[model samples]
Target: MTKYFRSNVDAMASYIPGEQPQHGTQIVKLNSNENPYPPSPAALAVLKNIDGEWLRRYPEPFGGEFRQAASKVLGVPSDWIVVGNGSDELLGLIVRACVEPGKKVVYPMPTYVLYRTLAEMQAAEIVEIPYSEDYSLPLEELVAVDGSVTFIASPNSPSGHLVTTNELRKLASQLSGVLVIDEAYIDFTEENALVLVEEYENVIIIRTLSKGYSLAGLRLGFGVANPKLLQGLFKVKDSYNIDAIACAIGTAAITDQVYKNACVAKIKASRNQLATDLKQLGFHVWDSQTNFLLVHPPQKKAEYLYQKLKEGGILIRYFKQPGLDDKLRISVGTDEQNQTLVKALSSLL
Candidate 1:
């Protein structure tokens, strides 16, 4: 019975999300990088309106309305958009499409962590290019990986440092592979790589409604790339990846630019204040262009701090991986939530 599983399945290394503890009412959850705010009024309205028909009929296989909404909002054509349950689904699809048995997939170390896990699931050779001490994208070294597929998370995860346009352009020009850019945190940043897809056929950018639009639980995301690349993906995707209720909520969220901008602005402000305060407390707080911060804690060890925070009804993420062993990733919560986290940290330190 133990030998029945495929070798790839048995050896598979899974992606670990931050803890979701349900025991406390006053808990401040700064883990999982989720938008601390709830979904927009428009999204809530759509959710409220849903009923029997939505539950009865199958949704459009391609997330047609969501695509159209994203197209109008992103200023890209609908043909360039492909919606998924979350950007994770789109990532898994890309892995299935581009990775053949022996082909390789390369991404920076200390990245989203899922890229390596997804590559392994495809049985693709995994190439890990370490980031610099400053956590910048090592494009010069990354391009050297002998792989046909390269996945990069812009304003990358855990550390939230974005790759510059110049660095990305250099990779596009030099690499012959499909360069998949995960922009899950792009809303918090001033720069984006969406325009690059027009100039480079190989650039695929994945986005989510989770962070920017505040619809994580709805599971709405899209991958934008050239039509040719999306066509290849269509063959491997599940028929109705986007459900009816999600499609409705996602469309409303993407179209409501005013609401989205306000939320992003608030989160950015919170992130900056948190970073400054953490630095003042003698922690090496990384400057983030996203909604979270990767901080080196003061006084107590990371594991100890994590436990103390947990006891105080606050949850932040701690990674057991090498290089990140001493760091904790904290998401920007609401104003009061942010204040509570700082206070808890202060008392503990």
Candidate 2:
């Protein structure tokens, strides 16, 4: 007889995180869309002051300081915010809270990948709506699907395209179910879906401290939504989702707007320069509002470029997905590291 596992667990497909290669000290890692810079001095100062009791006691169940700071930063109320281990944890909780076995869950295909994985884990039927060639959401087709929840990312992963507010509002206004705007990369863009949360009771916006704050190691993220939506999610999450140190560092990061803004400015400038340089080298670069650029290399397959770079102690993302086989998603590294990658590519191509 088969072991007594949940039917969903038996068939669920897991999300594959980007490769974390550990070999050379000289590796210029641009594979995962991680911030190229280290966390601001403010975050480091908080970590430096950690006391003995900090590790002994369990973190506050509500993460009051973190919530209040995050709320103020986002211009949302603290009561409507719920912090998690990472946005990935929040995503999973959202799925479990809204979706039931056999219900439908919709998301754009070739998105974050976790959306489909989470839906399947919950035993929900997956409806992956394809994006247009420009990677814009097919808003009309999305609304036509019958699903308990829809997940969409602004400044989408791998593609680095932003979904416009008009189309997003159209879906939020018309859809009967929840609309989740995964804005993990929203810091890289000039616009966000957060403003729509006030108008649509069903809209939930997820944000992270990973990219802009350079705190991926902190594993801090939060959800902004109507109190009712948060209420549903609160029922599913672990009692104390965030740790004390992470909460402290996250709060500090949010409060230090000057430092965060400066870092973002540098990253945006570097991203633009890198994009232009890649295009000049005969690669087709996608317009990006995020920390990474997706480019079609001038010569050799994307896999070949990826492998060659890895061997040369440089790393960038390359996908084997059906439509994305020709592209590589390169996170903006330090100027020197990026130049190193370019030089290596020049030699190979």
Candidate 3:
């Protein structure tokens, strides 16, 4: 570690993102919860029509065009929306804006690991409330934590379960600090907590195009909250956080709700089939509301299956963390890719 690095920076372990192999290699990628479908045709059209001259100028600092489109779809006013390079960036922004050094940032254990890393970067105290044995949200425990910022990943990653809306509203009402509902995969779920933004000034809901819109490569995400909370986030955000092309393409993607919904429908169907196949193979599959499954295999260890699958040209996620060691997070992929995964697993077992 460098001598000049901040003590917190030196001590913190950076977040590990999903692996991305080199271009052109053959692999069935189910590690990252990325949409297997193509982005909306309207988004592609926007990219095709990008004027080279526009690249010479800076993008709208606050991503007005994208926010306007998101506003129309989400039914929130434009001022209540703030676009980021991705929801990850927005997560960091929330920590920086709401958490002071030594303040607390609370989240459920076994949720997205990035929340801990972000809090660590800010030198904030992390309060992790463990989920119930069934992996349901521990609403009472979370509400008791004296945190400056609380993160709840609805339809949480690694375990595709969602916290009930009533439970979330109760927690939000009881919390003393900012409540951030990270709804990255909520598109696949039946309901969302966006309505809480209008009901509670402290509630902020973040969403991304990565999973639902098939725009992971574009790095587009946004957060909606009361105008007051958004004003604070704006202060901490990068001056030109979003690029011009991303704004144009994101606007196109959000405007084409039909295309986005079509892709989501396909993924949801595939998720069900994948879970059923795994269950049939004697694996324990958690009921998922997102485009992925948290599966516990029948015989071999999760790490072993992960390695064997990789050798067989399929990739899935296996977290080395304590509670997740026995499970694998398999992203819902195209029909062909999913079949390849099932065939590979059948042979390994």
* Candidate 1 local Cα displacement, residue 72, angstroms: 0.9
Candidate 1: tens digits of C-alpha lDDT, residues 1-349:
5598778868997778887776556678999888877778988898889998989999888989888988888899999999999999999999999898779899888988888888888788888998888977787787888478898889899888999877888898888889998999999999998889999999999999889888877888899999998999999999888899989999998999898899899999988898888887788888899999998987647889999898878989999989998999999999888889888888888
10 residues in a row with least lDDT, candidate 3: 137-146
C-alpha TM-score for every candidate: 0.97, 0.97, 0.98
TM-score of 2: 0.97
Could you report the Cα RMSD, in angstroms, for every candidate shown? Answer: 1.3, 1.5, 1.0
Candidate 2 segments whose C-alpha is farther than 4 A from its true place: 1-4
Q: Model 1, residue 199: what's the lDDT? A: 90
Would you list the C-alpha lDDT of every candidate in the order shown? 0.88, 0.88, 0.91
Model 1 spans > 4 angstroms off: none
Predicted candidate 3 versus true structure: per-residue lDDT over 50-146, tens digit per residue? 9997699988899999888998998889999989999999998999999999999999989999999999998999999888769878888888885
User: What are the runs in model 3 whose C-alpha is more than 4 Å off?
Assistant: none
